[model samples]
Target: MKLCFMMLTDLSKRFNFMNSTFQMANGYFEKHEKDLHQLSDQIWDNPELAFKEKFAHDLITDFFIEAGIGTVTKNYILDTAFKVEYVTGKERSDSTISESDLPCVAFFSEYDALPGIGHACGHNLIAVVGIASFLKLCSSLKATGTPARVILLGSPAEEGGGGKIKMMNNEALSGVDFSLMGHPSALNCCTSTITQAMEEKRATFHGKNAHGTTPWMGNNALDAAVLAYNNINTLRHWMHPSMRAHGIFTDGGKAPNIIPDRAELLYYFRAPDKKQLKPLLERAEQCFKAGADATGCTVEICEKSEAYDSVIQNPVLGRIYEKHMENMGYQFPPKDEKTFRGSTDMGDVSRAVPAIHPWFLIPCGGAPGHSVPFAKAAKLPQSFKNAMDSAECLAKTALEVLQSKQLFDEMKRSFKETCG
Candidate 1:
């Protein structure tokens, strides 16, 4: 009890610091709340799938330009990827300015909607929060001081496009000191746990096609594909509890009577971490080979994208952000009882840098994310306020990261050690 009280007291002091800074700059976000919610709702109304977010991309990029942040590149690393940068320094006020000493903080925004379920994942709120953070930060910096660099990354196709991986390969996030984003969930302060045990790998298999009725006359690739799936299912019981493998039949056959010579299956194998995941993947590959050999079918396996290593949450940064959240009157439940069943490209970022993907609560009576109920809740008045709150919290959190040299150093060290 005594220890808990002391921790809360210290947290209160930090919270007080965040609130003072935010209050002076809150008006900008407050005045823009209606516009923010409307933008979010507009995204909900026009849901676009992965790699095809033309409508979403145009709306958000236009808004960023209107705010004076000018888009840097569109279709940057992918068909729908883009980046917007806003750089400021004390030297900018005078005639002399040197760019070498500025620290760059990046804000990542994902706006792709799920197929057949527009904004069902609340990406609308996600987009607004990113903009809200930029707006508040701009207002705060105008009166007080400016940070080194503020980057608004408009990463598209997070639904399944692996947009961040593409951006990373292009060296787009090279100079970013830290990246931050918030995800809406059933509760606030949902801390992330590092699942360094297994990694996820995507593989696809292909085989020749033939007439279905005269199956013996030609190779039935679909049969070979089924055999591979059965092999994986049979092996599941013998594997570790954490081991998981599943696949979708992308090409079962052309017609019922035709011995479809070509068939395809996309499979994913996950283990606690890369070391364990590697062998499992190799073993799964052998199963596919065996299936092809048995059914007289040819096989082809393509890795969909790079494996996402486990997350490494920065505790110091998390606690600081948590304090700011609690100061803002947010309460979090215990992690053991909370449930988060989805994954993110941010997990890849966490593996590479000191990061945190904290959950903020928006009411749905324990509704699951990416569901119809959650989607409806996302448009509610409360949901918009949560978006406002998320913006304030993330901006305040970024300010803390910028102002505290000691904390900033600790985060960098932690990232090096964890990623190494």
Candidate 2:
């Protein structure tokens, strides 16, 4: 009897993969593959920084307008941010679909590029993934007149700026029921992270300026800076492998002959999760404070930018996505293999809503992200298709939620357990 039940469960999954809506989603992706590539290429061709993705923003918004899939709202929350919202469910004489029948879902796109390497992080592909995913789901919704809604949100400044965090503070994501996005990597995986909890810190040391020849006349801020650097280096010996605290002296002094009155240092601290992150940051703060105490220089330490939280992957949502990807013939890596995706503002998004940040393999020839080779690899044909397939699977996962209230409840329960 147990064997029969297992067999039936497997058959049900297979049936879901073979169903009409699944085909329709995949078909929409295939039909728009060229256009999708062009959009990604255009973003790659024109690299824009965070809060300054006007070109990419205008391009995507116009594309959505031309597609006529939903209502396009440009500059929705931030200057470069935009959203396309489609109400897929409505009353129809041929069907009994209702607007509130299913939970509202959202897909995110990040288009900002690194300053030195254009699209080196493969965010161009990320933008494509979001668009492709939304299109797939939107196509199915239109076809079946399903009782649900899907949104495509373009978030900017993900490279270093916390654009998503700003959007959340402004209540942009308040009403969204579920959120989904995928990142590009050398290997495909179900979760990018619990990625990492990360924060930026800036320190300014104040002291009296004195000639180098008269060393004892005034306090040396530069000395404090050096002490802080060494102290942080020392702290690393006791840090966990998953944690990071790296920094540099942005300002040392004007001349070798003078002891500068002011010095500045910038750092980024990261941990696997927020619990570990807080203590790591606190201990590191003491290291800086000790430097100031030793050098007799006053130190002011504060956040340089918005802090990003670690992602809490929704297990129930992940299982649904895995089945769809597996059915499409994509292989998963062993559980022990380490897939390192750096920090993201999407981590902040996950804390506010149930979310998944899957990583898909792009042909990078073993070059890690944020490099020239990875940037070139991102433009390859195969990379674009891989992103599309991942988007299709994400769309399938959304369809699963749209069909069952029980599934959405399970997702909510899992979210509470994982995040709390």
Candidate 3:
């Protein structure tokens, strides 16, 4: 590890010597700024839901192919989710360089949208950033003789479906030393502490149905669902500050005149970590049971999604990203008492490997995320600029990981030490 650090330090000096080259590389990407914005706008205009992003997947993958990066073995993973690799200086006459000998860096790109709002989560920005960064890095490496391999990860279904998780399970991230991705947000941050642990639950209440006029003869399923909701609402006051619970009635009652024979709901439960999640989930179940008992209804609670753990940031890699962004003329906002605390499937990936999912500030002012307004601004020119900026930063950070063995070793040690 120490020897790797020495080599990395030497490489860092070499990187510094290429400041002019870096400028040219960035300029190369800047030339495509207009096309990047148009692609982002097109994606936003036609949003696809989770696991069904045919348009987004095709657009991004086709762009990469046009950029000269070859697609890797992604059929092993989901069809929509694939990997693209760019290997520098494949010998004109001989080609026998093993992938293991080459340091691998990855950029995770998501392009799924919300049901009605479309790009509300700014996945369009994410996809454009990843593609632009990969292209820029490819150009830089080909020109500067940089010795590394760049991999772009096409991750889908971030809207509640575990696409990355499944990708990891399929060993798509194997042989990758470092992963880098950015989220479009209202403020800049090197690390996002918003990764809360999460669990999804679904419940259905069965009761007797009769005409509303003969209410005395019917057991109202709607009544049971309402009671359950109230119980969970009441439970919120006593839950830990880190704990969060919310739900919506999927089926309250079909008609006003008829008694509600069936009532259904989808509930989301969040905690600081999985250890705390267990007890909180149990309490929620008890509330469901209590509602059933009180309303004389039969209730069944089913776990929808497995508990997703909080994101674990690799400090070493995070600082490296911070350096890259600073070099690219960017700064993060001051840390506040109220940090971002959202939940994501990427948290699952962090648990298995060293990772960082930082938030890049879009032009959208401290606006509420995952909202319609946020979606609209995410398609603007300013958002495209920020996305391109993040792409460069993320690409540079990945380069640091590839060239600097010290950073990679520290990230590995940190991940193992923390997980163990």
Candidate 4:
């Protein structure tokens, strides 16, 4: 029989925990489940915005330091970003451990929440999965006498600030072989197997203002805004089916009676990947410029946040992850039915290194993500259970990669093919 990839259909198949390391990893996560739940709750209770996750930053650092699991860096590169490193079997080694001799696996944690809708995206649970997996992986490696390095990166401001990009620019991900993280998703209706490449642009129209009665004397910036909106609407009809373009007029005008001098809008452009997104962005610029030309107004366009590349799904690592998730009782939908949920900074990370950001099912009772209902569901007890399951699987995936050079090379080959 021809096989594309096995989805861990049978518990006794590839996912058998007979491997002592995998078994030990599972035990480690099970023992730390309670602490993981509390950490999730505390972060959920205190929702901080992008680049200001001080509470989460402090809490997570303290958790690692008190446990003595790794060497913790309080403020890593960014104020809200932190890093934890643990070398398995380091204490038992008589000679100095050469970092070059060991393969490194990094896990990312995002703690920033929505502006007002706290934990709407279940980022608190994401922290649990990342940290928990890192800890579990460390424990298993130590128990098995494996020489490896593990890292946990506390990334901030994913809501719109693109914290991962900031870390990438700072070379914070340097020396890491690959990265992994799991996210919670309750939206059963239209969840994508992978996310899209996304970018934000702010357009401003400059014109002269005049009294309401003498509107002709002034170039109405609001008119420019409306025209631009319409132009983009027309452009959408010709856009690629996978591409998405939408925006809101943040500054429509001061008063209805005045011919506004300035107007502003915020729009997002999404494509399957960064390469396709570039042309779409260029075309949108023309639409905005046309709107200004028609009204004899000048325009300025600026990017609001860092651009996010589409995720390069590494099939090799994906199969490793699928094997475990399936063993944990999560079923995968047919590939054709997979839906696009939205965009994320993790997209950028995938392009940089072999990475997986699987969206695990959470108990949201059919509530769409980022909603008040979804936010409430994020803290549900079952949600943590689901989160820990992912953590266990992640650690197992790490163990397999660290133990086999051939597998790591194959994973990297897949990354090259997908990224190239």
Candidate 5:
């Protein structure tokens, strides 16, 4: 009977500690709510393109400095990328703990906006959520003496630039054990569908130009481009249901009366995984070659961007985050329910470290992503409220990972089994 009572008491204390930590974080966010909202608005008002997020980058890094957090700007050779670190726990006089030895948790902030639509993907909200969570965690750690390190990474060019891959090449996540961030979406749910690997291919067909009246005198490049498009379309019937291939003609011809000297088609090929992507790419290249052979036009295929790998959500991390957000009053759909499907540079980060890119629903009235209406939805009052809740949930999850070695170990084991 005594042992049972003691066990109950310990459990009670643990619950109290968790509750207090969450309360502290929530209070911190509430106290700085106005500033966070202002920053979000500022980022929204000035939408920057991939790798050109100078305004947003400066705003975030400056905010970190003002908050007394240590920051390193222009990290990993990316001009717009920055890193912020906050340490908490008993201060060690001797140099016992190396930077790499300490358990490091990372949060990614994506501020680059979409072209023409401006914040259409709610990256403004994403940026603020990551920053706010990091700030709140910093406060919690300082107040509670939780021995851990937190990093806020400003990852730009998530739209298509593969900034995370570049950072990985530079060893940005060398010592990081875990990475996390929340994406604003129409539904609040843990990711069920894995993002596919994507690669961009551009095929340019070159041929001799001559008068249209004398068709035999010149090879028609437009005909080659059109045939290539049809070939890809026909290849679609043989492709797996999960495979996606789409393209657009960038240049068909300058005038209708002249045989086109050159034509170009840009395509994006996506597969469920990188292994499958390679074969699909081979087949796609063959389609382009077939067009060249049929039209007697030479073809040049060039890779436009780095291939993006599929996101591998660490299951342990996902469950912990799902629980925290649900405890914060967010209802999530079942795993089998339909959810949004898209790719992110977070996919690359996950491959490098245990990561979770949970999606939090902003009250967007069911608007689709990357649209003008979605951009407007990002500024709504309800969206800010949801953003605050997401911040708390993210911070809470990070606290769990930081404070519990068993939990962190479980996350790592799961990452290796699933990701490997």
Candidate 6:
């Protein structure tokens, strides 16, 4: 009976600690709810393309500074990128615990909007939730005397530029123990489905120009471009169902009467993993070469951007997030259910450190992503509610990691075992 009493008492203390921490987080969010909503709405109103989010960069940075939060603008050598850091428990620290031993957790926010459609991917919501979560976590840590470090990374150009990839290369995540972010989607999921690795290439064909009357005098670059497109279409028959190869003709020809000297085709290659993506890329290149051979033209293929690796989810961290989200009345689909298949630079971050990029639901009135309807739905009341709930979930999960060394270690172990 004494042993039982001890166990119950310990459990009660833990429960109370967690409850107080959550209450503090809730209070922070409630206090700043209006400002966060305005930030989200303002970002949505002024949509900026990749690497050109000056307005968003200034808005968020100024907010942090005015609130007395430590911020580093133009972080990782990117003009639009920034970082916010908050530390607590230094004065109340236990003599036994060293400052260097505290775990550092990171949250990523992406604010760049898509061309023509503006926030069609709900990146505005992502930025708001990320900032709110970071603020709440900072407040919770200070109020509870928890010795922890929080970081919020303002990542840009996730649409195509791979800003996170550049940041990782610059050692921006050097001391981060874990990275967390959530994307807006039609379904709520703790783990995103396996995203295919992507490689973009541009093939330019060079040939001599000639008049239409003397076609024999010119090697038609347009013919080479057409052949390349056809070659890819034929290769698709032998490709895996998950593998995809698609291209667009950027320059077909000058005119019908004059044979063009140059033609260019841009192609995107995707596969289940980098290992599989390599051969597919090689095969696609061969198709381009075959076009050049048949048309008597020379071809140059250049990679458009760095390859995006498939996401390797850390299930240990995912379970903690799943529990918090479930407690918030969010229901996720079964694991076997198809998750939205989309590539992100966060995939690269996951491979580098323990990371979680869960998806939160935003009702789109039956519209899919990258659509006008979806962009409009980002401002709906339901979307804001979902964002706030997701923020709370992320904060709760981060608190668990900060307070429990065993849990943090397990997360790292799971990441190494599954990702490495």
Q: Each prediction's Cα lDDT score?
A: 0.70, 0.83, 0.77, 0.82, 0.81, 0.83
TM-score quality measure for candidate 6? 0.92
Tens digit per residue, CA lDDT, model 5, 131-211 = 888888877766665556788888889888888888888888877888989888888877574677888899999998999
lDDT of 1 at 24: 68
TM-score preference between candidates 1 and 4, better one: 4
Misplaced by over 4 Å in model 2 are 1-18, 25-31, 93-102, 212-218, 336-340
Off by over 4 Å in 1: 1-17, 69-72, 92-97, 194-213, 335-340
- Candidate 5, clashing residue pairs? none
TM-scores across all candidates?
A: 0.87, 0.89, 0.90, 0.91, 0.91, 0.92
What RMSD, rounded to one decimal, does every model reach? 5.7, 5.0, 3.0, 5.2, 4.6, 4.2
Model 3 lDDT-worst window of ten? 1-10
| Candidate 4 Cα outliers beyond 4 Å, as residue runs | 1-19, 22-31, 91-97, 187-192
Which model, 5 or 6, shows the larger TM-score? Answer: 6
Q: Write the per-residue lDDT of candidate 2 for residues 1-420, one digit (tens) a residue.
A: 111222223333544433676665555566777888999999999999888999999999998888666889999989899989887545432244343443588999999999889999999999999999998888776666555668888999997789999988998786688899988987778753447889999989988899899989989999998899899999998999999988989999999989888998999999987788999999989988888899999999999878988877788788888888889888778756665557999888888888998888888988888999999999999999899889988888887776555677788888888777
Across 91-176, the per-residue lDDT of candidate 6 in tens digits comes to: 55555655455568899999999989999999999998899889778877777766667889999888778889988888889778
Worst 10 residues of 5 by lDDT: 1-10
Better of 2 and 4 by TM-score: 4
TM-score between candidate 2 and the true structure: 0.89
Q: How far off is residue 420 in model 5, in Å? A: 2.5
After superposing candidate 5 on the true structure, give the runs of residues whose Cα lies further than 4 Å from its correct spot.
1-15, 25-31, 90-95, 338-340
Clashing pairs in 4: 191-339, 192-339
lDDT accuracy of residue 100 in candidate 6: 50
TM-score of 5: 0.91
For each candidate, how many residue pairs have backbone atoms clashing (under 3 Å)?
Answer: 17, 0, 3, 2, 0, 0
Candidate 6 lDDT trough over 10 residues, lowest sum: 1-10
